[model samples]
Target: MAKIRITQVKSGIDRPERQKLTLKALGLNKMHATKEVEATPQILGMVRKVEHLVTVVEVK
Candidate 1:
């Protein structure tokens, strides 16, 4: 499977609990944090949920 880099670009403060939890589930705890993960359907779905809060890049 391909991999992608997920970066937390925005603050989760003042956001809904669900979004915050999603961030945590993606291994993001602080601003500018980045996690390299497989581009699985589940991960993609989570990213879609918080697309505004993060930036994604396809890994080579």
Candidate 2:
């Protein structure tokens, strides 16, 4: 499986509960925090949910 890097570029403050939780689930609770994760369907869905709050980059 290919890996991707997820970075929390925006703050979760004032966001919905679900978004905040998604951020946490992505191992991102702070701004600029980055987590390398597999590009699975489930994880991709989660990332899509909070796409506005994060940035995704392919991991070489």
Runs in model 2 with CA error above 4 Å?
Answer: none
Mind giving the per-residue lDDT tens digits that candidate 1 earns over 35-60? 99999999999999999999999999
Assess each prediction's global lDDT (C-alpha) against the native: 0.99, 0.96
Q: How do the residues 1-60 of candidate 2 rate in per-residue lDDT, one tens digit apiece? A: 999999999999999999999999999988999999999999999999999999999998
- By lDDT, the best candidate is 1
Which candidate ranks first by TM-score, i.e. highest? 1
For model 1, what is the alpha-carbon lDDT of residue 21?
A: 99
Model 1 bad stretches (over 4 Å): none
- For candidate 2, the TM-score is 0.97
What is the Cα-based lDDT of residue 38 in candidate 2? 97
Given candidate 1, what's the lDDT at residue 9? 97
Residue 9 Cα positional deviation in candidate 1, in Å, after optimal superposition: 0.5
Question: How many residue pairs clash (N, CA or C atoms closer than 3 angstroms) in each of the candidate models, in the order given?
Answer: 0, 0
